[model samples]
Target: MNTKIAIIGAGPAGLMLSHLLAQKGIDSVILERRSQKDIEETVRAGVLEQGTIELMRSVGLEERMNQIGYKHEGINIQFNQERHRIDFPSLTNQEVMVYPQHEVIKDLLNARQKEGASIYFEVEEVELFDIESKTPSVEFTQYGERYSIHCDYIAGCDGFHGPSRKAIPSEQLKEYEHTYDHGWLGILAETAPASEELVYTHHPNGFALLSTRTPTLQRFYLQVDRTDHIDNWSDERIWEELRTRVDLGNGPELQEGRITSKNIVAMKSYVCETMHYGSLFLAGDAAHIVPPTGAKGMNLAMSDVQVLAQGLIEYYQDNREELLNSYEAIALRRVWKAQRFSAFMTKLLHPEQGASPYELRLQESELDYLVSSKAAQQSLAENYTGLPIEWEKGKKDTILS
Candidate 1:
């Protein structure tokens, strides 16, 4: 097989990149290790920043999202038995869409299929060769059949654990990492949300969150020990912890229902110093990962690929290498900003295991400041709704020129 680009992974980052490239009249093939059904059903982050929503709309992929995704203007922060709201729309003229991550995958997949995009699923033993060379190729096996895709460029959207990043020699890439001693115990329940908007709670015991997935389905998360297992938490225990932590005193009562899914996610922030190695460009989780506190994982991935798509488009159109050459610096600016915000949110909400009384008081004071200062609320709203993509000029230059 031969193509202009070979995209590894079919997650949001890769699929979105393929769709965007198709809009530019570019041809690319996707290599995915999971079955189509697995990617569509995988549960992940749900919050969509305004930038993410706009990008999807630009690609004509927002029909279902606009119809089914819930829009929220603000989020409630609970601490010291008091609740305060950060008005996103009022502060930043933007709002977040509460749509499950899987739904986005389904929409992207549908659009890709409609465009007759090439995506090989359930691929095995995928490998990249001669990435530093002008012509890079990906070799993999499918159903005991060997195949190779020769392309001008290779996109490493295969995610953190995928082979794409590992293919980059460690000496050429500097990795920075910070792992939390705690993790999130997440659960999905078949019940109506307790509140109209998401609520982030800071309790002495730990941090908790209440978010809605659908009109009838809700998601909840509680900070737990890093080694905590799903087997250690029963349905009743999960509910009790949530109710106690998110207690807004006379606010909405949590409605209990059957928990359909549960899992523990270890918290960490990681980023590779360089996002590209020769003709192979890394995007999304393949390049950086932010703690989930800021809900920037999927949004960051989309942003990275959007920048990459523009760079590739420009390269193919005018034979310009400026955008492609600056892709790393451009993407890293946003990546670091998100990393700071996510790390800050994580530290603010999750108390250290053996935090002293002074440390707890400081955390409370920080939360208090956010509630009392409009400037603070505005800052949070701006970052939460997403900063404007700094590479908009590149996108316009490529698409319009």
Candidate 2:
């Protein structure tokens, strides 16, 4: 088949790219290794940067999000038993939507299904060939058959383990990475949210964040050792830790449900140069990753595709590949900004495991300044709410030597 474009992976990044390409009159196909039902039930980040919501609205995917997602203008930061609210709108004149990632996937999947778009699921052997050569193709096996799906371009929206990155020769790339000693154990419960807005709390014990999937359902996480096993923590132990960290005194009790899901997510960030190899372009987690602290991972992935979609539109319509050629730098600037933001937020909110008393005091003092000082709060608010579009413009203009 002579598809104009081929998107590997059906996650938010890949699906959104396809949708955007469709709007620009570019036909593309998406390949996913998982079935639609399996993807819809998965749980993930619930915070939507203001720009992400706007992008969804522009693409007509916001109706379900509007009806089901919760909107939060502020988030409470608690320390020393004192809760302080950082009003996002007060600082940046913007608000975020608390929409779960899975819900967004469902919306995209349903919309695509209605359009009769081609998305191959349960397909394996996904490989990228001649990415640095002319006429790149994505080879995969389905239903005991192998086929070569060719396209002018390939988008590696696949996650960390996907083939697109590895397809590029090691000699052409430089990778930078940082792995943290800490991680988070998250849970989803079938109970009403304890607070009207999200709550991020730092205690002498560790750290915890209170968020929601919907008004009637709550989602939360606790800082846990990277090697700790989920089996070690009983349901009662989970609730006890949650209560100690998230209780706002007046908030509703957190009723525990089946553990649902549990994993120790290692805090790490990665960036590699030359996100493009000939006709293949990398977008989303396939390109970079961030610790969840700043809630920037999903938004960053979405932003990459937003620029990519625009670039592909230019490529197909005006026959201009300028945007396409600069995809890596454009995406990386925002990626690094988020990486810095996530690192900053993660360090600020989680106490160093063995911090000296003086160091602890310093962290608390900084937190105090962030909450009380207008300038500090505005900086956090602006980066947290969304990044400016112009950030991509300057980065894309510089030529790679």
Candidate 1, 92-128: lDDT as tens digits = 9999999888999999999999989999999999999
- Writing each residue's lDDT as its tens digit, candidate 2 over 44-82 gives 886899889888898899998999888889788888778
RMSD from true fold, candidate 1: 2.0
Model 1 misplaced stretches (Cα beyond 4 Å): 392-401
- Model 2 is weakest, by summed lDDT over 10 consecutive residues, at 392-401
Q: TM-scores of all models?
A: 0.97, 0.95
**Candidate 2 global lDDT:** 0.82
Clashing pairs in 1: none
Error of 2 at 307 (Å): 0.9
Q: Root-mean-square deviation of each candidate, in angstroms?
A: 2.0, 3.0
Top-lDDT candidate index: 1
